[model samples]
Target: MFGFGIVGLLRTIFRSRSLLWSLAVYELRGRYAATLAGSVWAIVNPLVLIGVFWFVTAYGLKVTFEDGPPYFLMVFCGIVPWIAFSEALSGGTNSVLGAAYLVKKIAFPMEVLPLVPIVSTVIVHAVLIVFLLFIMAVNGLPPQLHYIQILYFSGAMLTFAAALSFVLAPVNVFQRDTAHVIGAILTIWFWVTPVIWPVDNLPDWAYAIIRMNPLFYIVQGYRGVLLYDQPFWFQWPLDLWFWACTLFVLLLGSLLFGRLKPHFADVL
Candidate 1:
């Protein structure tokens, strides 16, 4: 039964790929539809935030890495993935509720709804990555072969985000508060994920606990590739743990979403 569910889910997603892409494009445009800056805000917002953190940590707090890239680069690598994930999570959590009209349509494949935001964020993420590479080159840190691992790491992040969205979207249909709760959780989640600070400052035990955060693997992976030039396999243990956690979440989300799907229209 479980095998069948997984297979069926994959088939559904594959069949709905066109619809998913269309919706994602629509969502991306809708995000900045009326705004003057439109899509430019995607790059501008993160840059502004990164500038603030760089100033505070580099100047005010006197934070520095003994044998690492500049502070801002570290923060940039870490926050890029974070911004993508957080946006995907927040948007995905409300995907179903926001598309109530689609949910009511019996012919629609609701699984794709959660994926819309993720796909939309991926477009923005690609743009940020290009900007990141440009910055790296300007700072004399030219791109290297190890940067290819970005594809692997990004695929992992997308899978993790999609798994989570599957769980959150259905719940939000029944409990409107789920979206607000997710926002609160993400705020705390961000601070703890080492986006602005180095994990080396933490005690061994604290590092262990923080490593358990699935996002830690992704943020660190981005840094490893862009800054450290370390391959994904360099941290095999964390890689295994991340995949294990992601698979578990994927299974749980599939189960929860499947169980809850039947009632989504009714609830909405």
Candidate 2:
């Protein structure tokens, strides 16, 4: 069943590449198509958050930190991936809900809908990282050759998020409450993962608990490569763990979605 589902997903994707691409591009552009500032919102929002936090933490409250370029840079470093994870998960979670009309009316491969959110947001995320790179350079932190590892880290993140979305999209169709639970869980997750503060901010016992969260590795890997200019030595173990988890999630989600897919045409 798993093998057949994998084949189905691939065949659907290959056959609907044009459909997926068009929907993905349309969704992405529609975000700013009528906006006054256009793509400026993408850069501006991150900059505002970075500036506000940089002031409050570094000066207004005077928090101690271990990373370079001070507090703002650290937060921005973490925010890049956090934002991607947040957008991908949120958009992907609600993807099926918004796509109900299409699912009901069209005879197309349904898997393409879940993928549209992931692809569109991944593009925004890649663009966001470029802005981050510019910020790092402006702050006198030049890029290191080791930064090449970012590609691996980012690819892993994109795959993990897309795979997770497979399950979320299908589940949300069955139970709307999944979306609310997910939003609440992600809210708690943001604080627990050490984005605004260092892991050392917590006591050893508490830090251990925070360390168990998978999103921590995603945030840390980006910071490690882009900000610290270090290879992901301390993080390789976590990376292995995350990739393993991602693969398991993908396989299970595919199987579950496959088993349930025959009902989707009727359910919607």
Candidate 3:
């Protein structure tokens, strides 16, 4: 099952490379085509949320820590990847049903549909990273060599999100409630993942459990690279674990997506 799904996944992605880019680009431009704000809305949405988080935590709650980075900077770094993760999973899960027109077309690569949201979210993430860099500099934490490691974490996050969406999109089409369930799960998933709070503040046992969340790996990776100046290789254990889990999800999701795809046209 794993080998078959992985092979199909690689083949679909590679064979449909051009179509994937076209769909992703179209989704980006078409999302805000009629709106006045256009693509800027992507930047604005995350910025506003980040500002609210920063204000509520840094000022209202007076959240502080013994750290090289400021409270606001730390929050922003964590939130940026989260925004990508959330948007990708949320939007990608619905990509297939939303693109039902394409699903009916025999030639369309339905497997690539889940990827559309991942690509769109990455666009926003790139813009958010620029803003994060500026905020970091303003907060006295200049860009470090480790910042390059964001590419590694970001890729991991995109792949993880895409894998989940492949499974979710198919199931979501079968039972519309799957989307709603995912929405609720994300709400709970966010708090437990240690986005706003520091993992180091927790006791050893609690920290170990919380860090088990796959997102904890990506979130901490951002903070590690941007603020802590830690090398990606320094967290080899977690890296090993994250990749192992990612491979499992990718294989399982691919198998599920492939199995359910033939029925999608009828259901949709």
Candidate 4:
């Protein structure tokens, strides 16, 4: 049953690949079409937020890291992936509802709805990564071969986000509050995930609990590759745990979305 579910899900996406890319591109352009700044906001928005956080933490709170790279770079590595995930999850959660007209069309593959935002966000994320590398170079931390692991971590992050969207997007169709709840949850999740803070400051017990957060793996993996040049394999246990959780969510989301998909047209 699970195998069929996985196969069916992959087949649906594979068959819709071209349509998916078109929709993703349309969505990306439509977002900033009216603004004067247009697509530039995609890169600017995250940088502005990062700048504010850096100033507040580094100046207001006097937060400093003595043992590693500069605090701004550390925060940037963590924040970049996080912003991408947060945007993907938020946009994917609303994807089905936002395209209500398409949902009413019988031939359309609704499964691609939630994936649209992820594809669009990846474009912006790629740009942000380049900016991050430039910042690192300016700060005297040249890029290394270990940076190649970013591809692996990025795939992991997108997979996890897509799994979550698969679950939340269908649920949001039935209950609009799901979107608001996600916003609140993301705000809280950000604080707990150690994006702006160092994991070393946490006690062993707290660190153990924090390690369970799937996002903790992504954030730490980003830091490991960008700052420490640590290979993804160095943290085998966490890597194992992250994939296990992600697969469970992916399977559950696939089944849940399949069960609920038939009703989406009715509800929307």
Candidate 5:
């Protein structure tokens, strides 16, 4: 399945290189169309949320950590990955259903649809990371060599999004309820994650749970690089485990999607 997915991805790209870019570009334009700020809203939207959360949590609620950094900045750091994961899941899951016309009528590569949302999301994720860099620098904290873990971590996340997309795409085709269920799951998963709190604040068992959270590794990678200025190290066995698991899950997702795809047309 791994080899098939790779070959499938390559073939899809070769067949619809233009379609891939066209859909991505069109999706971007359609999303921000007729808006006053146009493309600028992409960055502004998340920034606005950051400000709101920062204000409410940092000032309005008076939430603070024992040794934690500023409230907003910490939450913002966590939200970056969360938004990408959330948006990617929502978008990727619905990609096929949303593109019903292309899926039912068109004969081009269908995998690209699931990827469109992920691609769009990853672009914004990149921008968020850049903004985070300046935030760290202004605090007189340049990232350390260990910060490079962000890439490997992000790679794992993209793999997760892709794998989940594979699963949800077919699920969305069969049971529309999957979308609602996924939505609720992400909402709960947000709080379940440490976006609002620190892992250290939790008890040992809870901290262990947090450590096992796949998203936790991604969040830690971000903090390790942007906040701690660290890079990938042999001391970090988490990367090895994350990559191994990510690939396995993606392959499994691909197989499931392939096995289920035949019924998608009939069911949808």
Candidate 6:
């Protein structure tokens, strides 16, 4: 049963690969179509926010982190991936409704629709990673082979976000409030996921609880590669836990999306 479901999911995306890429590119282009800076805004917007956080924590609060990297760098490491996930999930939540014309009027594989925004968001994510590398250079941190784990972690992040979008996109069409609620939830999720703070600062019991969050797995995974210079496999326990939670969400979300897909046009 699980194998068939996995095969179906892969075939859905794979068969629609061309359409997926085209729609994703169009979505990314349309987002900045009217802006003078165009797609460059994608890079600028996050950089500005990172600068604000850097100023507030490093200078305003006189705060510092005790981890391997500098405080601001560590914070930047976590924030970039969080932003990607937030944009993908939040935009994806509304994606079905946003493209209602396609759902209601056209013959389309609705399953792949949610992924369009996610792919678009990943384009911006790739650019943000370049910015991350530049920051590391300025901080006198040379690139290491372990940085390659970023590719692995990024794939994981996208997969998790896609799974979440599958669940959120369908339900969100039925209830418009799901999108707003998701935004609020992501705001809280960010704070709890240790973006601005280090997980090490939490007490043992508190750490165990917070670590249960699926996003925590990706957030810390980014830090593990970028700041800590640790291979992903080095943390065997975390590797086990992260994949377990991710796979659970994947199955749940896929099942939910499949069940709700037929109702999408009616609701939209």
Best by TM-score: 4
Residue-by-residue lDDT tens digits, candidate 4, 110-154:
989999999999999999899899889999998888798899999
After superposition, the stretches of candidate 6 with alpha carbons farther than 4 Å from their true spots are 65-67
Q: Root-mean-square deviation of each candidate, in angstroms? A: 1.4, 2.3, 1.2, 1.1, 2.6, 1.6
Q: What are the per-residue Cα lDDT tens digits for candidate 5 across 94-128? A: 98888877767646577778878877887888898
Candidate 3, residues 182-230, lDDT tens digits: the string is 9999999999987888777799999889878999999988888888888
What Cα-based lDDT does every candidate model obtain?
Answer: 0.88, 0.78, 0.88, 0.92, 0.76, 0.85
TM-score (C-alpha) between model 4 and the true structure: 0.97
Candidate 2 residue pairs that clash: none
Judging by lDDT, tell me the better candidate of 2 and 5: 2
Candidate 2 lDDT tens digits, 86-135: 77888888887777778776566788877887788777777777877787
Candidate 2: worst-modelled 10 consecutive residues by lDDT = 63-72
Cα miss at 92, model 1 (Å)?
A: 0.9
Q: Using lDDT as the measure, name the better of candidate 3 and candidate 5.
A: 3
Please identify model 5 stretches exceeding 4 Å from their true place: 1-18, 63-68, 142-149
Q: Model 3: residues >4 Å from true position, as ranges?
A: none
The residue pairs in collision within model 6 are none
Q: What TM-score would you give candidate 5 relative to the actual structure?
A: 0.87
Per-residue lDDT for 1-268 in model 6, tens only? 6556656877899999999999999888888999998878877898898889889878898776454567888889899999899999988998898998889866688888889988998889998898899889899988887798899888888888888888888888888899999999998999899988877778999998997887888888888888778887766687787787778777877788878888878877
Q: How far is candidate 3 from the true structure (C-alpha RMSD, Å)?
A: 1.2
Ranking by TM-score: 4, 3, 1, 6, 2, 5
TM-score of each: 0.95, 0.88, 0.96, 0.97, 0.87, 0.94
